[model samples]
Target: MNKRFALLLLVLLPLMACNKQETPAPAATPAAAENAAPAANEPVPADEPAASGETPAPAASAQTPAPEAAPADADAAAAAPPAASGALTPGTDYVEIPNGQPYLPLNGKVEVVEVFGYVCPACAQFQPLVNSWEKKLPANVRFTYVPAAFGGPWITYAKAYYASETLGLVERTHNDLFKAIHIDQTLKGERGQDSVADVAAFYGKYGVDPKQFASTMESFAVNAKLSKAKQWAIRSGLEGTPTIIVNGKYRVLGKTFPDMLRIADALIAQESARPAP
Candidate 1:
């Protein structure tokens, strides 16, 4: 039984995160493509998968795959899930982020930032779990999503995210956008090139004017946010999507998806226990 369990782990371990590589240059865009910078390569977790669509590494045959189709009600999969619980060992479960700081000012709350990319299949798989987890966070804990600025479709998606947030449409379109890219095949994520107009049209289904959406994707405001996101990823020492940083101090290194959240829960508790400054 122990050997069986170990074998199972060997099979599943590599699918936990999307590996970062030398990002391909951004494809031409109708707007602001020139502003998109190539993401710098950083060290990924030893077990992370290779670039999207490539064959899996020799040791692990199954890489992160697009998430299974969500039910008609997307929230149904995440509704009222049990809280994650586990004890954490410093070097085993997580490591401190070197020179790390919160992506935003803490004010009075504990900040949990997820560094993720829309084109990342692992992020798509982790979405439902995080969706439920974020919903249950206490008022004093703030959850923020900072999109990874890995180039190609990654930059395009990051721009779309900032534009949606600016337009007050993120709350409505977040989950569906994941579905569109991974499940419905309506949007090309990492598989093919995407333009500003292509992403704008996806948001159009949610009632925003496509032209305005495309323009906002290139707006100075959105560009500023994208730059900030890129800086945050670098500062966090992020090398892959679906990374959880707790209070900008600890970078989770769990052995499984649930284990990642469990360590994060313990770290959040630890941060909350810290005496006020």
Candidate 2:
């Protein structure tokens, strides 16, 4: 009976120890699972939205076209294809001469001269376009116009140009008058006193004193310019109006003023490189 009681007590003690060990393992398993779950499902921080707000805005660089683009476009176009070796080629109605050098002086101290008449349609076309080129022109270069008095009617136009010069309205009314007559078809008069009066009225409309304008047109100072222009016209091979002489040498016809400028530009570049005066 004593042996039986002792055997039962030993068995119970061993079983109790095993049960205690098993209970600790089950408790440890639930704690480990809780720690692992947080890593995969991490909480979004409260400052995430604020941090995104701190990022910079996308940039905008250019807005409008550069002011130099128009002239630059002209420069690119002025890169004219080289002319074929020539001496009176057939099928080519050539304005440039066989023996003559390119009109624009592409050397140092280039000079530009305008041979024009106010009533001339072609000269009127060239005034504004040439004026633009004048703005970008170098200081070393000089520009002059031969307001040729080839005829009685042409004398009035030359005098008008001289009047505008004295009044400082060349830029404002130079192109405007051209368009007024040619494009808009405004100026109308016979080649006489009526025509002179009409043109003076046009100047007056732009705020020039009509009396002063008329007075200057008849002045000795204006007459001198008209006389010199007539002399240049005889010497410059100018058949008609709107001939632009570059550097006192090459002459370009101003049929289309912009095209005239292009030819003039080419000649001017060449003139700019010559020995200084």
Candidate 3:
């Protein structure tokens, strides 16, 4: 095997070994888009109530008496649409984040953020599908990508992403970087060569100055973005890479790629129906 492909296997094999159970698929939908969920109890940053969309639930002070049950009418039951055929199920398909985080949408659009990582195989696999789905989204749906910054080598990738944005290279390099790492297997995570310095060198070919790239990677501005990203991932109730947060309110979980997009479509419709601001 080529050196790059070999290195990738080395990085991925260990992660596979540590994972004992695959991510539990939500209700069955499609097989193509299935990805293992990040192990439960993975270290999530403590929730900061002050963060947008992260309002903590208020403590209940009292319990009220139970209400009387209303009479069930066969007519009403027949008139109601079946829940099984619906596009989404609250709590099952997606979750409502407490106090919903604030979203920054352009031109009064609803926001959709894909919380993903470059090193993740699932994210890479999901990219083309998401890219196509994104293009077909309504003009009112605003989309952005937030690289996972949970630390270790992934932190380096996140820094690289932000740095590329700083240098105006993201649009050109984002997909290419994924291609390099996953398909081409050229961007291996070998220790000495996978650091920020290494990422700078790789992007250098795209006209980024290595010195400037390294500096930008560590700059306070980039760090601030990273901090916000970390908080968003934490508050979005993100259990793993490839999770989708819609309007800072819902974290979509799907059994298939189409299922995920279907959930997102429904959430977007719901968000679009909300009264302004």
TM-score of each: 0.71, 0.56, 0.71
What TM-score does structure 3 among the candidates reach?
0.71
For model 3 the local lDDT of residue 125 reads 59
For model 2, what is the C-alpha lDDT against the true structure?
0.51
- Residue 29 alpha-carbon offset, candidate 1, angstroms: 39
Local distance difference test, per candidate? 0.69, 0.51, 0.65
What clash pairs does model 3 have?
23-36, 23-37, 52-101, 53-100, 53-101
Give per-residue CA lDDT, model 3, range 1-277, as digits (tens).
3568544544443233112213332343222122323443342211111211111111111224355344388787777666555456566567788866844544678889887777765566567777778999998888988887755767788888998988899888987787777666567632223767777888998987888999999999999998788766655555655778888888876554456777888889888988886
lDDT of 1: 0.69
Tens-digit lDDT track for model 2 on 194-259? Answer: 366778888998888887888888888888766655545544445444566676666653213344
Best by TM-score: 3
Higher-ranked by TM-score: 2 or 3: 3
Where does candidate 3 stray beyond 4 Å?
1-86, 103-107, 190-193
Worst 10 residues of 2 by lDDT: 44-53
Question: Weakest 10 consecutive residues, lDDT, candidate 3?
Answer: 51-60
By TM-score, how accurate is candidate 2? 0.56
Q: Relative to the unseen true structure, what is the C-alpha lDDT of residue 155 in candidate 1, on a scale of 0 to 100?
A: 81
List the candidates ranked by lDDT, beginning with the highest: 1, 3, 2
Residue 30 error, candidate 2, Å? 94
Q: Which stretches of candidate 2 lie over 4 Å from their true place?
A: 1-108, 189-193, 253-259
